[model samples]
Target: MGALARHWTRIAVTLIPLLIALLHASGALPLAALDRLDNVLYDARLRATMPRTMDERIVIVDIDEKSLAEVGRWPWGRNRMAELTDELFDRQQVALAGFDVVFAEPDDSSGLKRLRALAQGELKDAPGFAGRIDQLAGSLDYDAVFARSLQKKPAVLGYYFSSDRGGGTSGVLTEPVMKREDLRGRPIRFTAWNGYGSNIEPIAKAAPMAGFFNPIIDVDGVVRAVPLLAEYGDQYYESLSLAMFRMLVGLPTVEPGFPRDRFLGRGYQGLESVVLRLGQKTMGIPVDDRVSALVPFRGPGGVSGGSFRYVSAGDLVARRLPPGSLKGKIVLVGTTAPGLQDLRSTPMSETYPGVETHANMISGLLDNRLAVRPDYAIGYDVVVLLLAGLVLAFALPLLTAPKAVAVSLGVLAAVVGLNLWLFLGAGLVMPLAAALSMVLTAFALNMSYGYFIESRSKRELANLFGTYVPPELVDEMVKDPDSYSMTATNKELTVMFCDMRGFTKMSEKMEPVQLQELLNAVFNRLTDIIRDNRGTIDKYMGDCVMAFWGAPVETSEHAHLAVKSSMEMADAVRKINEEHREKGLPEIGVGIGLNTGMMCVGDMGSQVRRSYTVIGDAVNLGSRLEGLSKAYGVDIVVSESTRQLAKDFAWQELDRVRVKGKEQAVAIFWPVAPADRLEKPQQDELKTWAALLKAYRAQDWDNCEVLLLNLQRMNPKKFLYELYNERVASMKLLPFDPAWDGATNFETK
Candidate 1:
């Protein structure tokens, strides 16, 4: 009981997320957000698993922009429709031609009926008008012409069902594929509609067959599937794709495919498939719980997919296409013109052509490749989620961080791999969002619990050490707290001191709050760069900042990171200045100094309050280098130790100087650029400077002066050359000492 009391917190932590995930999977707590996310996941899976090869069996006769331009506008007099139809069968010899457009209104663009009326009422006595009108009647009767053309062909007309309850419908609807009596006692659910818009009576009677082109839109406004059979006023009608498939298969009889278990006391035998019977041969077409088949998008979308050939409607009417180009192909006449508004959002694309959607469905149905979400999809989701969730929940508490991460990643990969396998291998598309979300959410919850609850010491350590060290280094220190302490210790590390130039002058013109804001913004950028490069910030003093690297987290590349941070900080100042210039404020500049040596670092101060900081002669030298930056007229000055350790950067020797309170002379250098970015011209300039420095050390004033002049000419605005020229002139006026090392000594810092 004592052990149970101790472990109760951990058990609760593990079970909480599992219970939430289980509830989600069992549909007891449905998330609309997750359902929407599931749609996106399904779309991604469909795109990845589709067979994107072109289907030569189907072709789209598009009333595209070109067709609209060349052949006037849409509903182009029925005579033109008759000409296109005749050209498809008579010239191209298509096997099956279907219209994706409905002839709901009569085409009167020919004006033949008006002409007849005018001839009888107003032009009866006019010179030869009646005789001429009678001669042109048969040619100009465009509706009759279009009807006669569709009379004997294997042409199927298209219409749409109105799901809107208040929408009134017109035109003549054909007979339903199955009657209400056929599915009387069957426990099947079909999508029902209130009204429909069918073809005009003359065109409807003329076409060999007809079907509705209505698509079922999901909650997210994406059309992923089409209902194979829909109900309207107790009659079941077929979709365009189903009708086309049926006609091709000798007009098979439609029947429900119910499992045998349904007869043996099954509660609700889910409608699995729609069985098509032609003689003794039967084929089962799978449908989802909503009685819709998932659309098998062959490729990205539209003409680019190449799933079907697209021939312009104008091209067919004008007979511009090659002979037999559409031969034996099942042609669908539709429009891709934006004005026609036949576009729909689908899984393949946001603006997919509705016509090819049907074509893809037809092709998928014939090939038996339509991915279906079976009735047991929710059960599969629940089982996977519960099992995987429980595994992670129980296992994560006993494992370390790295092992926990590996286990969680392995479970996620397994879930994704299995879902994809089912989709690609068995043509089964199950819900993956629930399983994936459960795994990810559970993993996150478990990790959160471990970090915030079980590992309180790590958090406390971070809170204590985060201000002095970077977050990453603090994390490293937390791993072994016994090895880290507030007691001072001597360690070899690199320290940096950075101060803004002319900040006092800039502040004189600004309000206190404005100056504070500017300082805060600049420091934020500099501090972020320092931390990003693995340097620990020690403290901020006035407009200056002091930071060090290689203490909390010992790294051999401490000098390299310190030097790199210095260079990036200088660049960051320039960017800030650019912003200042755009804002009509004074531009500011910063100077940085870096030194590498052994220093004492720990929490140190008076007994009243203490803080983590570094102290020693090496730290003082870093501050002295920052002060010398203004004297040298350069942005950055690093000690000789830093220059040697940071060999991967391009450096220019500034001077050999013995700073205040130091007798030993140390060489200082300015970081020019990174090694990879240094150009050949800069290398040549460095060589010239080296020769100049050598001559100066040798007390050869003439050659040193000449080199300074040449360097000044190369970079007219460079102050280093001028500073060196002045130093050489000053030294020439004084008596030369042969024992002198020619090191400039600064008496003040």
Candidate 2:
């Protein structure tokens, strides 16, 4: 958890996709890819669940190739259309017959206009041709004949609406299903058109009911839906399917329906359903946000699809069917001839019949089945994204690798399953693309954060500090590895510089390999001592080993640990010398120096070699102290800084000397042993040594000689007492100087 707390940046990255998706969902920004994917998903789902069974209520009267062959090609005079209508109503007795074609131009195949013109002109002066032409004009006028056949019949005509710049002028259109005032002056975004191609005036007045045959083509050129009601000028009109249904059920008046909200009065228009009001009773048809209905496709189109019973218009017109064979069936007169240019791309088929689109809508309307993409779909998308996205972001971090993957998959499944359930069951086509994309992207980001960022950080820390500390300490650092790096920093730490004394003479007595083995053996023991005290070994220079404490890992007992490690290393070297004596090899000497102060410690070097070592004046002093150790006849030399912090060990102050590269003299000391281990005689020797040092600094030659005689008499074998006696005898030759602070100075390292 602590490791996770430090990486807020990685956590924030996982939620970025969700934020973008939310912005898209809320309409602040829109993404085209998401919308396209949503359309693809919707198309797939729609195709998977389509009912292939036929709709028995609707039948298509196809003007197919056979019909065009038998009836002698298209635009076969209006008189032939009149005959087909007669066969459908008078003989077959269909409950309703709708023409999916428009008579936008007058039928002039009978030559009645030419004959009448001739009779009124030159022929009226010559013979009785005017009277003769009047007798044949009744049967020759094909438009009048077709119009008379459709008068007061159960029929509705299909026209087309266009968006052409040149407005319609060749036909007559019916009144709109509803007017703008019906919507209470609220602006609606209905699919609008500027022009139309309707039937001629004679046929239009005769039928007195018509609707446009236009399906809404999406950007991909597939007709997925149809606007049940659309706008033209300031009025709203209904599609052919809607008009046919209205005519079938007593012609209900259309009125716009809105969601009940007080905001409606404040100019917020949210059209929910289209209401067909009949007196006190009303029926509502659900529509999408654009006042459109999804085309509930029954199956693939064409006569082979079996979605609707297909009857060739030629057979129906030629009286081939037995009388009343199609009694009470709703007949839709449309052409399936390819040259007619009525084929459309739909979800079920690429060459779907334009007319059957209306047939399906009618069937769906009859069964009250529609899938609506509601206005609240954006809200649904945003909610699902938040839920699934947040789950992956916060939960994946706490889980192990396997669990994180499992949890992410589980979240994705839940999101997809719920979306599909709503779509298939409740007829709600909500936005699933944004939610699914957000979930999947968030999961990917989280896994990448762990694999690429956090895990990589752990590996880097292990590689950098692994050799400095023990494995256990390395493991602890890896948890929050960002806290440690190779960058140099200033820290208060204890630095140790232990050099092998008499290494030059020792190396001259052996060959290279043997000498290397001896040196490695000595360093192995010293390294073991330093590591045992939890100190970091900085580097090894020839026979000398440098180390430090409280770096890469920190502790308040750095000084004490360094002092303890130095004594252990000195003892281990002596033990190694004991084995050397038995092996007939030269005995090696070890001199160690320890100091504690603020110093720069970390990985520092050029490109070729990098080392985690300390650098500062204090570290230099520690090195100088190591050289002074042999001169003082002691095994370990510690500065006053280290001696003050490490109080567990008994200390003997050696001298106050100004070493090379330093102006002020610093006190130096030697760690004898634990204070409890010092005997009374050793204590008396140290007291005598202190008195001798005080008398020597006072320039009292007689007192110094007397004290040194007593200290040397106590332990004449001690080199420290003999060296101080030499120092006292040599100082007697120099005259007393008042400027001196009773400290010795060394000019060479």
Candidate 3:
């Protein structure tokens, strides 16, 4: 065992790097997948434990449906927006007001004609397109009113960056927040164009300090991080959220740190921190000098009501709101109507309000509640990955299968738990994906190579049983053949038996050589179907095949798989018949029966002719069911035990019968195709049949008979209807047993 362990260890060590490389190359094991998994786990954890809202301060001004209906249509006149701004600064006494909506054009609702007429006075009455001229003049003058509102308070105008060439159509931007000279010899690159802002002259002049509100959404469209500053041409611009945060904290001038000489070359110092110099005190603001910050979203939908403070423009204009509500809050004016295109898709909500995101960010900054990935995070990830790989490589090879699995799972859980703890407790966002990758790589390498190393043993077992059992089962048995050595032990297992209907007459007409080829092909197809469903083929006798589940390997879904495979096999025979007809060969049909019960399974038969098979009353019933298939004129028959495991498929209870040698009656069902595939009438008929079965099982003879009659009228070929008819006839002649269970028992094997 020690020698074996050492060999396994050596293989594990050699395979880890290769597995990592393969997973990376295939793109199957993506960092993004881990990120998604992390998000899912986090969401579930949040749901279960109800993560307390961290100290992060976030407030929402919701532009909800109520606000939209009352405020009129979206893109309300700029004059009304200006009023909202005035209320925030004067009434709410908000530290800063940031516009998530852009004001690229003047608000024409203030009566451009009136402004022009006022400016021109007597000339406004002049003839010849005077109204048109007044309109243009009024529009130009209204720009000034909007700008004046912005000047009354510190406000950050939100704008977006466009990667498209057409972005230039939006016009030029204001002076940048950062200059090219400031970056020096950094490796930063910029290729986006600034676009789509309400650039009305009045608004621009009023709010000189603004930020781009373009969030850096990942490919999955989740906003996890925000760029603090971005370079456009030779200038750097701050994000709107960041700018608002800066203003709220008091607009302190920032001084660039001096350059420092490093081993690689001359590098700039203080790239990760900016000094905010205020009056007599200076505070260091931690940032990734490259101008990005990790956004600490407050759970899903952001701190419960953080989506917005929904208020209608109509309500404000009507003075319906209570006093002091908007007196001191930084209110954002934006839309939540889906048609407005201001909504964003998020894991938490399909129609996420975009403007509220800025509120959350600003609120978070003010509360000094921020989550960050330290500068050394990438290095930390690399270290974790390497260490995890090494640990798995050393430990997996020395432990048994169960122990190995336990250790792997434990390590995985530990890494994820620790990473989440860091995120929640320490405000640190660690790279969980990289750590998980290490664990996955280790497992894949060990399992992949273990199969290769154990091929000789597997092949020997396969050679011994492949002729009888399915190839998949043979491989499973080879994993630990000794444990499955011939024995008689009771264990719940699903058994299936399939036999060709009317084979004797069909075979007599065909040549011996053709018959052999046809039977081989049919059985081969059946074997493939069973293996595909993870069922173990027990043996084949002449035209009959026997397979079982929960032996050689154990699974909770064995009964489900057995029944599903039975249905699939029946479908396979139909397809086979179509091919046989095209090829001018004898057509064949199949009957399948599945039973789930405690049975003795092991390698049975003499040592000279050993074979693995199961035996018990359960196995006998399965064979009896195969014969009953012909009697009922149905392709597949399943006992109650099998039906219990079928969670997905629909079925019809065919009968309650005591076949040949069984004392107790059994309930049998025929698995039906999906409801979508069945015609409307067929679906109705099946419903009726099910109702009849229920009534019959309850000994409600009159209702059962009525339902069965309706079922027969709807679909005459339904075997279940005929079976119920027989049962109803017998109930009239003999007194029913009150203790009679709905169980169907088969007396023939």
Candidate 4:
């Protein structure tokens, strides 16, 4: 039952994140903010790479506010537009002239107004004369002059299509670039016009080709792509850009290639490329059939004041141009001023010229430098999301928390990098935001479940073992219960034993209550310092505190931590001494000793009374070193192993001595501040002390005494010199053991 419960808990921890990630990827838990962020990133990238100049073939005749103020309001009388067209064709030799504005309403002044004026003149003369005049010139084509100008030039008049009832006008659609049969069942809704704005008869007769200039805006209001072909009723139409290109190449008809169902289960189809067979030459235009081609805007400032030459209608009417400047150029007439409201909000710029956008598309079609979003992009995102979820679901169950975190970070980085490579290197825009969200959501959910569900029990276990083991160590044990058990085992760990030097003497002077209070305060402070340094408290023996490292938690720096903790404990004891002195009580001092060697660290007592503590030769040596601190007049003493680990700190060798029990001698040293912090004189004195220790180890009594005497003279407060002085005196009398080792043997534990 316990095993089943554990397995179920693990599964729950894994599955929760997987579900969350999948939901996030599928848009069930939509992240609108993320999508916006993605758009911003893409827009920034596009802006960074915007073309500074338009292709020489394309030109924009901006209907700017300046032009508007110069020529008077919009419907600049079709006759004036017709005059501009005549100048573009006859004077400048323009290859093609395309209008971006739609003339859905005919010029009333040309036709209706002329007829009415003639009728009014006749009515004034006689009642029957009005009827006779109306009969003579029944359809007095008032727009005859405007129609004559339009017929003189080769022009492609612009018109718009509307999905809503109120917007469509009466106009015919041109032939489609691609047939509906190519898209299978994908519905293509095209707009049809029910009315004409210009002289329809003249426009049809003059301009051999006309195309719709309608642009489709997406839900977000950004025009990323334009449809190559649109259908209205039974007729299909080409874009103005497409129609102009066909006219330039003299290709009456062009075809677009669209492939179907080449990606995942989702039925996907779009134009692979457009093929224009012009006379004897064939050109391939790259564009997605479904959406419009991406327009590379030059930027807000555009190519040198928006990078296009602006020739005003007023200038053309006045014949002020340098003459023949518009010859053989594809001319596009559109508004530029913000007040005109023809401005569009794009990812790159908030106030971009809509006509410039068309120019970019047309130029892209001509140059074949186009970007495409593949049909498989959506499928790729879905696959990534599901795979990320599944991986987290299966992997989270078997790994520890730290390992799981490492894996999650690695996976997240890989997904982000892959998306970036696809975009930056291949010009393919893969879904990074969605894929990233999936990985992050999975990681977060799994971590949450682990903490809220599994970690609570682990925390309880930690609390139970807190008195005997460090929390970090207990946590590690909980993660792998099989590897850790409350059994005695020997291992190399650093043990530290600290005790108050004058506790007994101080307690005799203080009242019982005061003594207890002081001892509690002192122990609490010292215990916390020990645990903070990652040392587990073994036991507190009255005034003595014992701790060790490398038991419940394995650490490579256990020796270093032990030495550091001992120094901290000694400093804490000195602080307590100051408080005791302020209260008119006897001051207290502490001695700490650290030793590193093999020791059994686990529950070590009768089953009912078991305590987590260390028991071995090294543990006893640590206690004895603390007791010997008073003899050496030093606050902290560390064995050779501990000294080696504290290489970053300055230290002075004290002595080579054998305690009561063992014959082998041990080397001990006192840790000082870091070497860089030591004064020059102090450093010199330390150097002398080292020389004295070397002499003593070599059993050269006279030289050892000489160096020790010099060191004591230089630094009178240095206890190491004093201790070595005594060692030299004793060694001089008793011939040193020839096989003497720098090992300190503890006589009593």
Candidate 5:
């Protein structure tokens, strides 16, 4: 409940199914599928617990293929049926008999009507024809013959009710089991029909005790239950099974049974059961909201099925069975012949015989084992679902993984177990599909929400980082997907430009494929070093590979990383040069530049082609520094801004120069080595070089020459000092400039 207040969105999502199930249960928005699922669940439970043992007390007299073959096709004259009835009662001594077949029209197969018509029309002049027809009239009336056989017998005839007839009815309907006055104006809704197909007047009047044999077909067209009582023209009628059971128990009159506890109060639409009244004794036959009872099928149907014994009508009519063979047995006479069309699709079997359903019901009524979806079933479903739904909705978010699983499983088990207990222990058929579905659905949704929220973001970020950085940096870079995108923006970032030298000369000596392979190899080594330090590769252009930092993801040590990768890349080229000497390949030289400044870093280009790259003056200056590296005879050059930010390395001030596009001269430096790794001799050489630049810039020719001599002696291989020495010597012969700022200016890129 508290989860609904706090995590209302997730709670609301889980409640959608619950709300639909509730609506279905309340009859406001009926879900035919839900009812079908309930039937499926019931069928599963029924099949698992079926006794599979034969019921000796109840038997089915099947009018099957063998019977049809032996005694002609069905409607074998009502005179033959009268013989079969007499054999069941007088010879077989069955306790009660019920017909599952309807006799809506007279049995005219005897051809007596045709003979009388011929006598009145064409044969009227033949005096013997009329006289002979009158003589055979008493013996030829098949319906009257069958009716006489039913009189004074414990026989219950069968009929069917229908709603598609448009009030068109045939034959005569039996008296009501209970009248409208018996309900006392409670407005109880019974299964009502518009028309019926009952027995002819003679047979119906002979055996007035009758019931409709219409099993209640659910929306999915499966016979799960049968209405024990139905309504027709303000009169309630009993079912075949109920009628047979009532006659077996001394023909009790039926009364309406009302439940004392209908929680819905005035909204209750049906009775709990039909009360059977006999003297002061009354027995309650439980019914569902439709005044129906679920058939407690013992096992499968048909004669081969072990649920009930089957006696063939042909064998019984031909006296194949000995006298008293079915003594004291309650028999249901129904046909299984293909022509009869009595087969129905039941939960147990698709081609189940219709008569066995009533037999199962009769057996249930005998043992009081009829299962019913009670009048309070909807109320029960709502209460159970609300409790279970509330628990899962509120508890799942609060519990840990194992505890949540345990709680959900416990609730599911409780709901299923309770439902099964009602089915197997007490004979009750209640709604379970909705409750179980709600629990499983709610649990699944709640558990997935917690599990996928973080993982989903991590997965997306991993894809973004997959190509930008090395495999090792991906885990750390998975921060927020919303934090970065291809959208262009301005931020202070560090950009580096690395260019390969002597590439044109090397290509002249080697084949095109060989040159391509060599260039790729050199760039691969450098790119690995850059990505190793959290740098995003911008693009590879010719022999140069550009990279930057603080994008897609941010890092404060962007300049430090840029310088570090630059030094590492220079060393890697030296190793490749060593390999080149050993393998008889051309040596490769690298020049790298590093600068730190505010720049726009994002995906920017034409709509047809785009890239995640950087643009601005800082980037342009970094490129110029790469070009100046060859002029100054150095492998790596860094801008003053970068040197300030990256204080970990020993710096050598190279120059203050203006590139083609810039007016302001930015100071540049060379990273000699790590500050702690520089030796005393190297330190002295750097100081002497700094002094040489100071004297040269001040126009002290003698001091500059003296300082250059000392710097060359300290590091004779250093080209920067030699270059400055040449400049000083050339300036000695010319007039010294009064406005020189000691800044070199480059006229072209």
Candidate 6:
């Protein structure tokens, strides 16, 4: 229960954005940016899924520049419009035609009205003028001529819905697709308009069907959908595309398609689709909440696109079209000329002919392949968001950073892939913007916590072990803090002790501050050398310093590091002396001792103050070795155990002596140059010295003396050889014992 509670808490923190996105999807809260992003995704889906090939069933009768030139510009006389219509049906045998333009006023370009007035006034008495004018009146009435051509023809007239402009209704509107009485008891909201522009009364009466061509332009001015049904004064009207499709299928009646749950519950009254019913055949046309159907573009764009064939309007009017060219096809009359301003921004094209939009919609409806955002879209988004968020929130805390990143990436890919699959396979327009945003946002939040909080944890661990471990080892310790600590543990390690020689006498001669400064300078240089070789400083006891390795973090080369630090420390003292000599101060020297063995290492001391240090017999022997360095006339002396571990360094046997406090004998060696850099003379000298030790250990006094004399002559300044010679002389005075061994026992520390 506690784990679940903790998981829930973390999930809640990261799920804040998911909650907001859910609310936005549910319409409880609206986000403009998300809405715009959804539109962009919708556009991309349309472009990706479009057929991008010529439909060949629908053709555009375009009023191009060539058409305008041949027909003498736009607003051509109605007599010319009659000729175009007559030529299409009579000569081209087009099955159906729809206009993307409207004529709101009568065309009197034939001068018939003026001639009638002249007949009634000035030309009333002209010879045979009244009779001739009456005879030609019928032919001169261009509005009547156009209306006669459209009478009883399978032609749908187009119009526009005017909104935000007050009190402007032009021409005459056709019979509404559905009357207010048709849906008297049903609850439905249609897109309403204040006024409209329609064809003149004569044209409206003569056309077989009429529908508006006004599209539902989004806030970004991109036409993504068209209202299949619009309302004016509680009367629903059909769109041009919807009207053409209905006429094709024997004029099916339009009805609202609302979804219900449990057959009895009016759970959601929102419109889901627009249904067309002809006898028993039913077709459901998907619509959005606003009763608009998504525009199904067949290709890339309207004009340049190859979705529909375009024929110049002037060709039709001039009878230049081949017989049956538009036969058995749906013809839409529109213009692509830039001056006509029929171009619109659509999902498929920025500058598209308005007529092609209707063609695409008609094709989509006939094929029933329109992409629909189902009513359960919001529910799906919420479910996906919560599932992804919960999984990330719970799993991120338990896994390491790398594993958490892997899981997040997997979830992200699954989410995106599923969305695209639904879009392509099911023709379902699901909401991806919210789901994708939630996934990325949650992953970012999880990773940010690890980066910031773990960084602070690394700092804390560094502070805890910084003084007792190298910086590099401290970093390793922080990587797994639970397994590392300051508690004492017994482990085989190497410890080193270094002290300045003659420091007491030097301090007695100098002032207190001067002595302190000199000690600080010497200790700083020595400590830097120790750290450089991966040694940890244990403490600074006045002029002496203690350090160790293979603690807090394990290393296999602890002895090697200690010996290396010791050698570097000896060389560093020489550099310090050079600096002191340049400054007219007394030069200083140091003695270093290294020993390797099992020891208890960790924080040790009183409660008032404690320190991370080592304690055991090995640690005591290391101190004894440092004190023995002076007696051997050398800078560094290491125990046999340390010497065995550090085989890469050159060594010279110092003595076989047991320091005070212990009776067991142990061998000590002085570290020389690195083995790789040792000179041949030094190698030869070591070989001769080894033979001398063997002779001395065997009680052969004469051979030992002779070997020592030769070594002294070869390396005259070697005080260690003189000490061994003195030992040989002292042993010669004592009577030889058969059980005696060459082990010198020191009685002082």
- lDDT of each model, Cα atoms only? 0.86, 0.87, 0.68, 0.70, 0.86, 0.86
Candidate 6 Cα lDDT to native = 0.86
Global fold similarity of model 6 (TM-score):
0.73
lDDT of 2 by residue, 101-182 (tens): 9899988999988988888887878577888888987789899899988998899998988887786555887998888878
lDDT of 6 by residue, 201-263 (tens): 988989949899999889999988889999898889999999999999999998878775633
Model 5, poorest ten-residue lDDT window?
A: 471-480
The TM-score of predicted model 4 comes to 0.69
| Ranking of candidates on TM-score, top first | 6, 4, 5, 1, 2, 3
- Give the Cα RMSD of candidate 5: 13.6
Scored by TM-score, the top model is 6
Please give, for residues 236-348, the per-residue lDDT of candidate 1 as tens digits.
Answer: 88888888888887899988766445332245455778899989999999887667898888987676677788888988888999989889999999988989999999988
lDDT of 3 by residue, 1-749 (tens): 66656676565564566456335423556556666765555444433433335322333454556666766676766666656666666665555666677666545665664656655776656664466665565435555656667785777777777665665535336557567776565655333454445355557767777778777676667655577677666577777877776677677765443334553223333354445677987765445434466554544453254334455545654456666666556666565656777766544565666776666566567666666655445445655666666677777776666887898898888877877788678666566654666677777667666666678777777776665556766677777777654466778999999998767987789888988888999899988988888887787888998898877677898988888788888889999989988989778878888889989887778868877789999988888888889777789989988888876677877787787767777888888875447677767877787787788778888898788788788878866568668868888676777887765665555
lDDT, residue 303, model 1: 69
Going through the candidates in the order shown, the clash numbers are: 0, 0, 32, 25, 0, 0
Greater-TM-score candidate between 2 and 5 = 5
List candidate 1 segments past 4 Å from native: 1-8, 115-139, 165-167, 184-189, 259-269, 459-477, 480-749
TM match of model 5 to true structure: 0.65
- lDDT (tens digit, per residue) of candidate 4 on 1-749: 45536656665665665565456555687677667656666676667666666467777777777677887887677767766777877888888788887655556754555656766875566557567656644244434445566664656767666655554446444444655564455553333443333325555555546766666666688866666666655445677777877766665556654545565525544555556776667775555536455564555533255556666667776667866898888898887767777787776566767777777777766666566665566677777777776777667656678999998888888777777777666666655666676677767877777777557766766665678676766777776655666577888999998887777987788798988988888889988888888888888898988999887778888988887777777888788878878877778888888899999887877757778889988888887788778778898888888888767778877676687665677888888766668778868877887887678778899998788778778978967677677767877898668886644455664
Candidate 3: Cα lDDT at 552: 63
| Candidate 4 total steric clashes | 25
In model 5, state the lDDT of residue 429.
81
- Clashing residue pairs, backbone N/CA/C < 3 A, model 1: none
Residue 487 in candidate 4, Cα distance off native in Å: 3.5
